[model samples]
Every structure is written in structure tokens, then in C-alpha cells.
Target: MTIDAKRIVVLVPARNEEHSVADVVLEVSAALPGATVVVIDDGSTDRTADEARRAGAVVLSMPFNVGIGGAMQTGFIYARERGFRAAVQVDGDGQHVPSEIPRLIECLEEGADMVIGARFLGRGDYRAPLLRRLGMHLFSAALTVLTRRSFHDTTSGFRATGRRGIEFFARTYPSDYPEPEAILLLCRAGYDVREVPARIRERESGASSITFFRSIYYMIKVLLAIAMGMTRRAPVRRRGEER
Candidate 1:
């Protein structure tokens, strides 16, 4: 399929990534010219919104500071309303590379409901923090048990989902610290998930929301969310497809 017919959109949910958002947006836009790009500015106190818009993305600014989950859910809503065939979540912090987008687009074309960029599939160049890696491993294991399928990179933000996945997330998605548990949520809704090989860069600037104190808090919160998503599951039935 040509890029225009695919209706693929790149969703960038940014908080305070003012320094990186501009360059990232421009690069993604150039990489996928036919694809529409939307940047959700989640109430950043800096020039995130202005800079993102100037960089040539369709900017959506939230009135209040919602978390990453909220910002991404908003992007899902946009895709749903705009009749986009697929939506790919890209980090505005310059971690995810734009050149790898075609592989994700190919995944959607190949009939997978969701495709995640696995940083550890064959490369560990991202060099995630030790504690974060532990958290990801633990969550990946727990989610594998819950989903009854192999999911290596549960915390990977580089994910592409089709219209069904977009619609599902528009109605329900993670609120805070949503990386790992969000996969469980997608599985309970009956979407088939796959992981792809991709590399990520370290953050160029700014600070992560997951500080030492918040890391502990996030681990507990995500654990609770995983358990809750498993119990409170309802399949989205589309002509008995269960996807």
C-alpha cells in the first residue's frame, strides 16, 4: 500500500520536551511525508506546544497537565475521528528513530493488530537504566503470563496499532505509568500483539518523570493496574473477530 492509502499517523505525546520535539517532529514528517503527524502537548510549562506546531505537526494541546497515558489516548481519539487506518505511537523525546517507521507500517499491513518496537529483540544499544530494565523484565514476565503470549518489551513506547486498536484505546487506555500494563489492557481486549526489532537513543535533555522516589511508586501502581486489567477485561467484538 502507498503511504497515503495506509492512513498511517504518527502520534507524539510530549510533556516538556521542548528541546527535542522540534527536531523529532521535522524528522518524522520528512520520513513519512504522506502520513499525518499529530503532537499532543500535555500541558507543558515550556515552549513544547509552540515549538511542535512550528516544526510542522498538527499540535493538540491539553488544557491541563495529563499524564503520558492521557496524552496518548487523546491521539487515539484523533485517529478514530479522522478515520485513520493505523496509528503509531512515537516518543517526542527523540528516543525512537523515525527511519524505522516503515517497518512498523509494514507490520500493520501484514495483518497484525499491534506492533511494538522491542529494544531488546536483538540489540541492547538503548542501555536502559538498571532499575528500569528490572521493572521492564518483571512486567514483561507478568504480562506474558496474563496474556498467554510472548511479549518481551512491555515498556516500549514505539507501538503501531490499527483502527480497531485505536478505537479500543480511545475508549480505554492507561492513565499514568502505562508502558507495561498497557499491553495487558490491549490483550484483554483481544488484540494480537507483536514485537519488532528497533533501537532507541538515550534522552537528549531534560529529566524523566520516573525519579528514584517515583520509580518505587510507579512499580507499585503498574502492578496494581496489571492485576486490575486482567480482572476487569471485556473483549471488543467486531463481527466475532474478538479483536
Candidate 2:
């Protein structure tokens, strides 16, 4: 079960993404040569697991569809357990471009525990709906006020994490609406989280998992989660005491 720690691994969390998983895997593999790509097929009823494997990725199929947060946590656990030095979270929906992975990794190598490939930091082709854009701004402002750090996109899932970040999330990751909450968790634990501008391609196939109706609920849940996170204390781990 020994894997190369020198190579940065790309972790893809997928659910019923039969149409796009293979392409994502191949692009990731090509984009980061020698880097291992693993797919967490989150209880997909389609051929996601098989397609990913056929595309030359190590696939871990979940028995049930945990939300995106849970699936990502699983990937972190896998990466940490295998002694990977770092991991990049790439979506199976094809929105996250593989070519931009190195930029995220560069930031990670420059001493950031977490590097978020932010969509709104610089000009990009990504254009969320007006309502979604407003919600993003609200979350960003709230996070900035609470954390004392500027946050442009609190909901972007495209990110990379160093070993410390991976281990931290492996131990205590949020299961629901994790992106925004994760920033708070890492900052509380004394980890450096940075953001780099990256572009996102609109999905050409399949509907997004989050619907318009669910987005309202998602916003409310995330805000409450962030508020609760502020009051809580992050557990500090002693050196060599990792579980």
C-alpha cells in the first residue's frame, strides 16, 4: 500500500458522473504526470467507478452516497493514510480544469496548508446566476468579518492541501456544506489557507447536484455552520501523536 509521497495526488469525488468521470481522470493524469489520481465514486448507480478505473485511476467506490463533503473527507483520509505529501480536490462534473492544478500546487509548495482555486479573485469565464452570486458575496463578506481575512469565493470546491491540511481534515472534516466551514476549521487550527485565481468550465452534461430550491437551504445551513464554528475550539495535535 506504499505510494509515492513525492508525487502530488489528485482526488476526484464523483457521484453518478458516468458521462464525465473518464475524461476528468484522463485530463488529470495528463495534466499532472506521475501524480496518482484516485476517484471516490460516491455510491454512483451508473458506471462511474468502472469508467474511472478504465481511464487509469484508482477508484474507491462508496457503498452509499454521502454528500460532497463526506466524499471529499474520504479522499483526504485515503490520501493521508497512504502518506501522500499533498492532494488536490477536483470535481467529476468537469467544471474544474485540470491544467490549473499546478497553480494550486505551487501555492501549496510555497507554504500554504490549503490553496483554494478561487473563481472570483480574478476575471474568469465563470458566471453564476445573479441569486447565487449574491449569496456568494454574502458568505464571503461574513467569512472576511469573522476571520479577518479576505475571502472572495467561500464555496469553491477546487482546492489543494498539503499533508498537514490533509491530516487535519482527515481527523475532523465537516460532513455537510464543508467548503466554507473548512476555511474556518483550518484557520482555527493554525494552518495557512491561500487562494489562487482559476477558471471553471460550465458543465456540459448532467444537472448540478444543488438545485435552485436547495440553494436557499444550503445558504442558511452554511451560515449557521460558520457561526457555530466560530464558537468551537479546534483540537490541536501533538507531534507524532497523529491517529
Candidate 3:
């Protein structure tokens, strides 16, 4: 019997994304065949789970509404339990193009611990709102300072994680505003990262949850969490660790 060393999985953390859930899952399955696609349905009021299951992806439906961070941590735990070597964290929104997923795998195979799809890195006509872009840059600057590394995109949800990254976040991950906080956590954990050019499409349907007021507070709160996480160290004893 032979086993494959290169096991890749795509994780979609979704909530009330019935409009976009099926397409996202089907597209990923089409792009990367022979790999499992798991969609963590985060207590969607709509038909997100049904649509995802119909699209041929395994759906892990949360009993209650957990934020994106919790959904993502669930994916990490599944990956650890399943012994998957590489996993890609993709949003349920249609914004992330499934065609670009392989690039992240290539980044990991090429020896990078983490790869983030940067919209500014030779991208096409990106349509992110002006205010969001401004906040994105500000958070990027703050994260670089906190992690002591150079990173242009902190809030971009398009990213890939290797074995090291999967195990790291499964143990300790942020509760809110995790897309950026994960970057700081990974950097502080001594993981090497690479940013590559990728063309992301605009959201096809469903309104984004980020409002102007929440975006402001999200920026501040995430920045503070990352700063503190960077400075703190894990206790010598983990939950299941034997002393």
C-alpha cells in the first residue's frame, strides 16, 4: 500500500451565504480534484449547508453561530485529526477565485510556511471600497510592527496554511478579526510567509457584514489583540500536555 505525502484540502467557513456557497464549493472542487473540500457552515439561517453538501463538499454545520474565527479553528482541528498536510482558508463569499488556489499550494511546496493572496500584488481591477483599503493599509502597518515583519495585506481572507500553520492555529487562534491576527500569530511563531499576485473577483451576491463603524472598531480591536498575542508566550503546559 502506498500513501500520498501531498494531501491538500480546501476549507470554506461560511454563514448565511446561500447565495454564494454552492458556487464557491463547486468551483473549488472543480479546480482541485482528488482533494477534499470542507465547508464549515457557521449557523446559517439560510440554506448554506444544504447547498454546500449538494455541491459535493463535506459540510460541518455548527450548532450555533460561531464567528469566522471559530469556524476556521474548527477547520484546523479537522485538518489535524485527518492528517492533512496542506489546507487553504477561503472565504465563503464569491470574492475569492478558486483558480488561484493552486498558487498557495505551490508556495507551500516551494518551502514557504504561509502564503497570502495580496490584492495589491500585480492584481487586476480590484474593487475594494476606498475606506476599507485605507483601513487595510493601517492594519498592515500595525501588524508589521507587532510581528516585526513586512506584510502588505492583513485582512485579506485569501490564504493557505501548511502543516505547521494548521497545528499552530488549532491550538491558539483569535476569536475575532482573525484573518490579520493569524498573520501576526504565524509570524511570531517564526513562520516564513510569501505574498503572491492573484486576481480576486468581486462579491457576486449577499452584502458584506463589515460596516463602516464596525470596521473602525474591528481595526482597533484586532490590532490590540495581535499586539498582545505577539508579546505573550504560551504556558509550558498545554491543555493535553503531560508535565
Lowest summed lDDT across 10 adjacent residues in model 1 is found at 234-243
lDDT by residue (tens digit), candidate 2, 1-243 = 232435677999999999999999999988888999999999999999999999999998889988888888888889888888889999998999999988888888788999999998774778988778888898899888988888899899999999899889888788877899899888878888888999999885788777787889888998999889888776575444333
- For model 2, the stretches where C-alpha displacement exceeds 4 angstroms are 1-6, 238-243
lDDT of 3: 0.82
Model 3 lDDT per residue over 98-118, tens place: 889887788788888789998
Clash pairs for candidate 2: none
Off by over 4 Å in 1: 1-6, 237-243
- Candidate 3 lands at a TM-score of 0.92
Among residues 3 or more apart in sequence or in different chains, the pairs in candidate 1 whose N, CA or C atoms overlap within 3 Å are none
Every candidate's lDDT: 0.84, 0.87, 0.82
Off by over 4 Å in 3: 1-6, 234-243
Error of 1 at 195 (Å): 0.4
- What CA root-mean-square deviation does each model show from the true structure? 2.9, 3.0, 3.0
Clashes of each: 0, 0, 0
At residue 232, candidate 1 shows an lDDT of 74
Could you tell me which 10 consecutive residues in candidate 3 have the lowest summed lDDT? 234-243
- Count of backbone collisions within predicted model 2: 0
lDDT of 1 by residue, 1-243 (tens): 433534988999998899999998998988888788899999999999999999888999999998898889899989999999889999989888888888887887888788899999886477778888888888989998988998888888998888788888887778888777667777787778888998887877777778877887888899988887778746554434211
User: Of 1 and 3, which scores higher on lDDT?
Assistant: 1
What is the Å distance of residue 113 in model 2 from its true position?
0.5
